[model samples]
Target: MGVRGLQGFVGSTCPHICTVVNFRELAEHHRSKYPGCTPTVVVDAMCCLRYWYTPESWVCGGQWREYFSALRDFVDSFASVGIKLVFFFDGMVEQGKRNEWVKRRLKNNREISRIFHYIRSHREQPGRNMFFIPSGLAIFTRFALKTLGQETLCSLKEADYEVASYGLQYNCLGILGEDTDYLIYDTCPYFSISELCLESLETIMLCREKLCESLGLCVADLPLLACLLGNDIIPEGMFESFRFKCLSSYTSVKENFDKKGNIILAVSDHISKVLHLHQGEKKLEEMLPLGPNRALFYKGVASYLLPGQSSPWFFQKPKGLIMLDKQVISMSSDPESKQGVPICTEPESKQEVPTCAHPEIKQQLPVETDSDFNLEVPMYAHPKIKEDKPMDMDSEIKQQVTLVSDPEILKVARMHHIQAESYLVYSIVSSGEIECSNTLEDELDQALPSQAFVYRPVRQRVYTLLLGSCRDDISASLAVKEWFVYPGNPLRHPDLVRPLPMIIPGGTPSLKSLWLNQEPAVQARRLDALLACFNLSSSRDELLAVESPLRALCCLLIYLFVQVDTLCLEDLHAFVAQALCLQGRSTAQLVDLQLEYISPRAVQLGSLLVRGLTTLALVNSACGFPWKTSEFMPWNVFDGKLFHLKYLQSEKGYSVEALLEQNRSWLTRFHNLKAVVCKACMKENRRIVGRGHWSSHHTGRWGRQGSSSHRTSSSCGHSGQGQPWRDQGPGSRTHEHDQWRRY
Candidate 1:
């Protein structure tokens, strides 16, 4: 549904812009021309590896590992050729697409089920060992990323937007991903492995500027065109049939407009024209109308254009200085240079410092640039200062210096001084004690309005917790948002209540207090209540069999506390495991029980147990379920109920009786038609006409004896002519007359 005909239209109208080049060629070009220049690129890693997670022949068995290894090697290849790669992973499905997310999740589960079924059926087959299951592949990807030490930034929403944003902000050389939506952003170049590579061993670079030119549209107009054409977030039925093609034709015929031109207004005008051309026909407007559709379209526009407004944390400008320690220097530099240089030490001075400059700042001397300095002494120290007291006569010895004749020593000495000076500057700037001539605000005043810096909105409070790793940081962030930000907000989850302890600072609430401090025995007595709440039967014995019934209860409480009914079994296990770890306990047995027993039971009791729970836990938690809120939700155009008899009658021009008659006529026409295939060519020849035409034209071709030598007025006038039925005089006349009558 992405820009309905975008890929094909672009290929036909603007092939040069989407040009592909080989990997080796691209790498060599950069190597020769932009040597030692690391061109930064944002990678949609998840999109790149999506197929690997799904069951595919090329990505079967250990092939996924090979694929990931190959991906790492590709990144390394770029790094070798001076390309800085920043990998971005999708964290959650966007709020606007939650309905689509749910449908996709359901589809994926069905696919997983199908794969499992196939594996079960082919268990004894030799080729059964060919593929790894989707779940196993997903786990392996995480492990591979960790082992490879690829630090990926997880976007809170659409990774494409984040990739586009980062690429724009940093002026990245390009964005590498499979999504064509990046074309809508029009800020950076885009690269795709599939699009770029003609062969397995080749890669290509595409030209974005040329592509826009070919389409006869400016880059800024793409998003509006995409909305009209339809995108993943917007349904194709939202627009009239063939409207996208008309828009493409319209744009292709016109000159490109400036960015200041009202592109959406132009689209609306075109749409109105199309609507008028098909005045009496049933179109998207006749079904859903324009007012609501326009609003949704604009919402999509705002979402993509102003993604930062949704996730403020990601857009926050990082404020800090990068420290260049010895380890950092060694890692960045070649091994040959690591051991050659000594750490620079400052020379002591006895002279009094000025009151304006702090003693700490004054004592920090710039690295000496001289090449003839002694190796063992500080760069500022003279030979006389080391040997004896620095008298007025000794100062003359320092003035008379000799240049180092060896080029290698001089080069090393120069590098050392450069590194030392860099460290000194960093120390002074980061210390924030030195007064600057102009502040950032002052600089902004002198700058053009477009170049001026905009301040980010400040957070009300900053929570600092020692999260061990990225996973913990994500979990903590989610927990804080659920417990603090969304608590008691009816707009989110109307049934959920905020815990009192979470509302108060420094107040820690135990599971018992949150659940009315009910004892284990008391909770057991009220097990019926828990079952009823989830719409489950009271007599479920598996719940009682666990070693710690309380742990199971705690798991349930945590799930409900998060205010999400549906949860991924893996995520629930992880959260429960973390909670147990905090209480100085192990969740090994509890996690096993939850996966095997409790989760299945919960699913049967009308709870959703999706394979991927991020959509619910993170996405829905951030921007509550669309159906629950008063905001307009797009109708499921594909729903069968929309075409039901009652619904059809509700529409102005549609009726069940008319639909039934149309279906019957279609069926009759389909059955009456006979498929004609040429025996010699083994391909479709032509559809046979009526009985008289077929008998006259095809009798000889089918080796049947039928007046082939007879000279008749309307049939077989070319007697014994040895010509095809189409070319024969009498047969052609009869075929045409029959076709005319049939029409």
Candidate 2:
């Protein structure tokens, strides 16, 4: 999507094209030159997100707590310096970029294969070069920033365009990012986020004017250079003939015939010949041996042109774009219209200009700076204006995604859709589809199973409630259809399978009751119902004894045992053992353990539990979200590599106390929790009858229709052969419900 080899070509060959300067130096110069001005930097958030998350040990999965901490430090560095920051995120799928997106994914697949091979062969984690950003990173970033109280916006379209335009519209210090395309835009200055040493705010800025002067080309000629060098709009192959022609004539520097810098120098030399001439179009057409590209060339140049005039006080003002702040979420309908903040962009009367400060109000004292040159406040303050600075802190309640978009989800999940789950809230939602992470493998090398199938049962239950349905019974969830986006990987399913069956007690509150009923007892019933889905039936007093933080996760493990047949008590102990590993750990203290690739079977149990947790969150979101999802997030509860290491310890028959390496009281707590899980999970009982129904079904009498004289024992309550008439999950529902009722 960028110039094929231009970043390196200019960075190495044409030194004038790129400039490396310290950001602290720039800040000092700004302070010394214009002491009254506040420097504002517009940031491309996606660029920073990939950089921050890529170098970690668990890039394949994620270290969310560490990632969240990195984001806080990044923001505070600017805020403490009195530098205002506005973050823009990429939002929609542009028409021509779909193919580009697919190509990159296929490329990443090759890299991912190499990563798997390297980890297994070398028996260690791969270095920084081999990594891809984990799924749901953007959503996580936005959620974190919002929670951090920072000023941010999700773009209605591509963020680079919005970033460049916003920078130019507001007269920003620069557009801070790593994209080479930023050089092509005629916006404000472009800065390199990669070169930034945040501790001192020292970084490099790309000086476009220096490059233009050195190359004998005008600022207007930048887009033409990008096209001639081969960008996203026009294929590089189309200009191969012209590039070789330029390469042959340039003998000053002996390099590869198709070397990027050599070609850049040659092409610009030719461009200099045609500048301000009558033959500009005719001369440029010669480079297009395939055909003339006046339309596309114009389009590429037009993309760099800034649109509209919405300031930060307003917004980008596109159809689906919304402005986010701590106080409110607002959107603009008309491009030509200005919006809130109660400030004036122009003077009320042209005859008399308004001055910011009166002579009497001018400052007389020299301002003092902090240790890091952090100014106490913005140099110039207005008498009436209030500074609503965001709280500089980390994410306290980070609530956090998925492959497969249901066709029905489009009804409410579209851009500008009022629903909170709508993707429009993101600046740029992924145009392409993704497979769910933590998927199980089948028969060794299939096109990978649909991560959808893994979570379908849970999601379908959620879909039934969120989207509504005619059938009131839980079985109605089975009818919901979800479409998975596998990209290049074709699934091996015989019929793509169907709904994942969710098993919970009938007495659990309905979606309606969870939402409308605000009583404390209703909350207790909701938790009970959630646990019952995993078949962990606990009394209120028993649950109160256990910590609430790990209750949902403990219930999740039992659910995994019920769903996954191969899972044993060892697996249950392994997951809980990691929870012990996470006992009161800080963001800095988290052990960065790595892994050598193993069988999905080795870690598939953890994956299943992870998916199960996602289901719980989705269900919670559908209701009023009474539960704190942050407390139950996968990062807080499980680490795949740590689980595998702990599991091996348990496989050798380690006792619960030995596994946790704790005292007798901890053993008591572990044994008690494990006892509850073991009892409820001994047999996968799909349904638990109500108090009155329980007595009638198991102890009252034998079945009316069959063996009326036989007496049923309480021990045979959950037996498969007994009544054959109760509701079930995985087990079939018999048509004998009417016969079991008492008069």
Candidate 3:
């Protein structure tokens, strides 16, 4: 009667068992309830065991060990209160899969042998008595046969007796296991510690008494008592229906297995079906319990029934008894009032109303019998009245409701909008204007504030607007170096420009002056033309006719080139800072521009700038430079000679070789500058760079590592713009060009 029976079904092999002898205060009341029982006596063969090895069971870990120790000490204290020790075991088995039938049987035999050895040792203990019973499958088979007159192959053989003996001798039939299947054959009262312990022991005793009265059961014949409670009724049929629901037809795999094995497999599947249904709906089983009178009623019925092990099948049961129809008899099947009465607002004075069946009558036929005695019984009118209530159908009803208050959402929303706006701006720029400023207006109405802040300039061209906005914002906001090396507008929109400007800003000369005079206000005219070009809303043809895209682009390029022309400026200003640092006598008077550019550092910057501009010119041949091409100050061949003369005298104390060696570095800077020029030229040209050619151009300059590397940024890519000159050497002009050379 120990924990063996439960263990067999659940497939557990844990060594320890913990049983609650007295639910609340067994030590306090043991003597009063069972005075005849020996002092230190326990329910021998009754123990509760939980197996962690089963798939259904998880290990309780270290805490469970502590719990078991606590229970053991509690039981030892009970011995002090005059209750003999008792044990109840479900059962245990060695682990092996039944797929290999022979090995599984052999392992079961070995496990059974081990159990017998344990039982014999326990049986020798003084003042000990054991009562064990076969329940579950044994009781199920017996009841099934008694009810259905069917035979089952589920019998314990003589050799199997040795295998089952320990389970029957030392293990309690129902005490320790979670299963209710054993109640079918068990002879004693069964209680689950975790659940039933919550109730008072007196209440438990009362429930048990009522349960026995209902079924007419004695504790010794609990299995027979269970039969009265409908334990053997296979509602929803047996295993075959379960197999159909859970597995494919045997015929599908029949070709792969022998006929006998297939039959055996089906039987096994049926067993599995019954076992699962029994566990799955176990709450219904707990309603049955054991005591004295209910057992006698089951014993009186005394019919033996065995279950059939055959093709898996399910029994169909009466799911629900619905009332189909009712008939008003007038105490007769045929009513005399079949004719219809006229429809009227008021009850028509005494025209005999022809009666049809009541609405409830039409719905209650087939289930409720039409007989004289039970015609209008209200009790059986509808069995489903309680089930018709509405249920809460919302999926989120169980979820916690909360409002979002995080600022990260708004920050992200703003960033996203700025990025989108930047793209729109890119789509609007044109080559005709250089000084165009795009003012993005946040047009975000309440509808989609998260998507965008403003509408871009062009209404129809929205395709690239968002992307353009985002690209610009990302470059600006991140502060990545050289992010916008070339930050010119996409291209000057042709519509924004005009035919001409009377005068450029900064008192610079106009294009009219440049074209009209030989040397009249050279800087002023160049500046005037730049301003005019940016302001004019003229097409390329008109602009070229007036002062060419080439002229405008060249002027702009040269101005930037001069500003960043590292070596020329470097050479011109190197001596200024030195003279001041040494407080040397003024050998030569310097101009305002020359005096202000006082550092040798400017020399290196000038070299880089010159090289950069040269590269820009070479690369951007399409529309000329971004600035006016006419403004290019061709290198003076005379300056080269002047440079050589200065080096020979060592007037600057810098060597000629040092200056000459800078050619390579200058060429590299020149290449990158040329690339920018080319892009600007294309920007002016209106013809997009061919996709394949541009990609090749990009890869050749930037390589696969992209624009991140500083040492070898591409010649034409923009990320190279911020690089500063690292080496300063003697000044060297790239090629000796005549000053003021005409194209």
The number of clashing residue pairs in each candidate reads 5, 9, 126
Judged by whole-model lDDT over C-alpha atoms, candidate 1 comes out at 0.32
Tens-digit lDDT track of model 2 for 673-740: 77656655554442222223333334322232234322222322435343322211221221111122
Best by TM-score: 2
The 10-residue segment with the lowest total lDDT in model 3: 448-457
lDDT of each: 0.32, 0.50, 0.24
What are the models' TM-scores? 0.38, 0.63, 0.18
Ranking of all candidate structures by their TM-score, best first: 2, 1, 3
Better of 1 and 3 by lDDT: 1
Tens-place lDDT digits, model 1, residues 1-743: 23555555555444566655554555466556666655676777766665333222221112233345455666566666556777665544444564555445444434434443443455321233443232223323433454456545544344676677677656566787776677776556777655544234344455556655554555544565676767767776776544544545555243543321323334535544454354335423342344545435544443344212221101111221111110000011322221112211112321112111221222222121112111111111212222354342133222222122222322222222222111111111111010001010111111111000010000001011101111443433221121111101122211111111112222222212322344554434234332222222222343343224132333233323122212222222232222222222122321221111112112111111111121121111111111121111001000111112212232224332343333554333222211101111111112222233334334323122333222122432434333222223211121111110001
Better of 1 and 2 by TM-score: 2
49-149: candidate 3 lDDT, tens digit per residue: 22211111011001112222334443444344443433321111101111122233334334433433433445221121221111111212122222322
* After superposition, candidate 1 runs with Cα above 4 Å error: 8-16, 23-36, 51-71, 124-133, 136-143, 195-201, 241-290, 304-743
Error of 3 at 334 (Å): 55
Score residue 84 of candidate 3 by CA lDDT: 40
Segments of candidate 2 deviating more than 4 angstroms: 28-38, 54-56, 92-95, 132-138, 232-235, 238-258, 269-272, 275-301, 308-452, 459-548, 551-563, 587-589, 592-624, 639-641, 663-743
| RMSD to the hidden true structure, all candidates | 32.5, 15.2, 39.7
